[model samples]
Target: MIGGKGEQKTLRLVARHADIWHSFVRPHELPHKLDVIERWAEREQRDTSGLVISNELGHRGEDHADDLYDAGVRLFTLAFHGPDWDYDLVRRWLRWRDAKNA
Candidate 1:
């Protein structure tokens, strides 16, 4: 659900063109949304198997970050909406990623 209220339109476009799908949702909500997306993908016989799921690291915090990661969300987005941004968590996450990949 990247675009407007047009769910079908968004899913359709994602089915064809999206390498990844980004959304702002709770960890508990991921499966249901993926189910909806899968249903929609099935309509067009579109496979979302190759699509990576992503989310923002807002109030989600560290625990939720781990939760989302376990739920298959590998890409986490952090907004730098400031004159001075904190790189601590980002660096730690990168290191974690490296260790995981290694």
Candidate 2:
């Protein structure tokens, strides 16, 4: 389940009830967020191994990819957004992601 701002409380509540803890967070702030999650787990004495942390990365750049990976982001959803909604743009991103993974 994806959660937004002011959603952390709901996220924590849902995290306990659900299988995933999905949210949008900047790469630079990920470590601190993860630390917060770790602390929350420690306090709740909850085994957080089953919880998944997912992030939305609009474009996959080397530095961003590395930062996200280092921050324990396992799932990434790339987006294509603008004044014009174009499938071609999304296709291009998929191609890029595929080549990078390759």
Candidate 3:
């Protein structure tokens, strides 16, 4: 779900058939997109509580983890490119995950 039309179409199927929805929307857009999913789920008589929301995190997303988490994103896929990958983000997120679980 990337473009507006594609996202909308995907969301409809997500509501009816998906147990997980992975979104590329930014942190600010998460709530609204989630609301749309909820509405579609309601239209289909589906409960979204069991629906897992996943988001991808690049360097730009490091600062917004809390915001996304608060918005109900439970799964995060971290992206690292290039031949030399920096593990700092990985360490940071691991620490954050530990603290959250603790």
Candidate 4:
């Protein structure tokens, strides 16, 4: 999974090099970006449905989590800054994840 993003070249790279992308894009932007990626994938005869999606929890937390999930994100990275961490958020997501995976 490519856990990052960049400019136009980023999409080109994602099209040519990635099978899964962990975009730095905000939740609202994911669909469009995914569409862009899908178009590229299409040009290469790649099946868009086979691509996996991911995001960093720091982007928006659970507020956008479910939507991201619904939009095809299967992986999520929780970025913790330092000493303090939000295990509660993790737990909640874990619950949702486990159930989803189940």
Candidate 5:
């Protein structure tokens, strides 16, 4: 389910009903979002051991990537937007990320 705004409650409901929680995340707010997830897990007495946390990183920014990783974000979808989509830029960023991870 794609949603925002009322995400805390929605996440709880989704956690209970769905197998995965795919959600969007703003770079600066990722920590708080993870905190909410941890809190929700504790409150619900739910084991969130294998929950998949995915986010779209539309541009290449080191801090954004680092913050997302620190917040336990595992999956990322990179996006490029413009009249002419830039595959080169996306490829460069992917290489950089892979190098960093390596």
Candidate 6:
């Protein structure tokens, strides 16, 4: 996987060598970042149709998943911290994902 926060060099590398690209970029910036990746892929003569876009949904998983999906993210990873964490968020996201898949 190629991981970066919308860096041009990183995107270029992704275009050249990756099947997956992961990042934590905000929803508002996702389109532009994708465009950059497309441009880089074009330059590298790579077909980006097989590229899988992934987003690390830090603390904003519940808030941004839908928007990120709309913006082209196909895979998601949630952030969990501490020993007292709750699984409710995971259940909710799972439900949402199920509904989307359905």
lDDT of each: 0.72, 0.65, 0.76, 0.74, 0.67, 0.84
Which residue window of length 10 is worst by lDDT in model 3? 1-10
What candidate 5 gets wrong by more than 4 Å, as runs, is 1-5, 18-20, 42-45, 81-83
Q: Which tens-of-lDDT digit does each residue in 1-102 have in candidate 6?
A: 989965668989988999998966888998888888889999999998899999976667555788888888889987777697778877877898898799
- Once fitted onto the true fold, the runs of candidate 2 whose alpha carbons sit more than 4 angstroms away are 5-11, 59-66, 78-85
Q: Which candidate number maximizes lDDT?
A: 6
Q: What tens digits encode model 1's per-residue C-alpha lDDT throughout 20-90?
A: 88856677887877777787788777778988888888745567888888888888777765567777767
Residues 33-99 of candidate 5: C-alpha lDDT, one tens digit per residue: 6567667777888877777677767654767777876677677777668899788888876786797
TM-score of 1: 0.76
Candidate order, TM-score descending: 6, 3, 1, 4, 5, 2
Q: Best TM-score goes to which candidate?
A: 6
**Residue 77 in model 1: lDDT:** 75
Write down the TM-score of every candidate: 0.76, 0.62, 0.80, 0.75, 0.67, 0.87
Which lDDT tens digits does candidate 4 get at residues 1-102?
555666367776777777778886776788888888877777777666777787776647565887788777888788666578777777777887798789
Residue 67's lDDT within candidate 1 is 83
* Candidate 2 Cα RMSD (Å): 3.5
Model 1 lDDT, full chain set: 0.72
Residue 100 alpha-carbon offset, candidate 2, angstroms: 4.7
lDDT of 3 by residue, 70-102 (tens): 778788778877688778878888887787678
Clash number for candidate 2: 0
For model 4, the run of ten residues with the poorest summed lDDT: 1-10
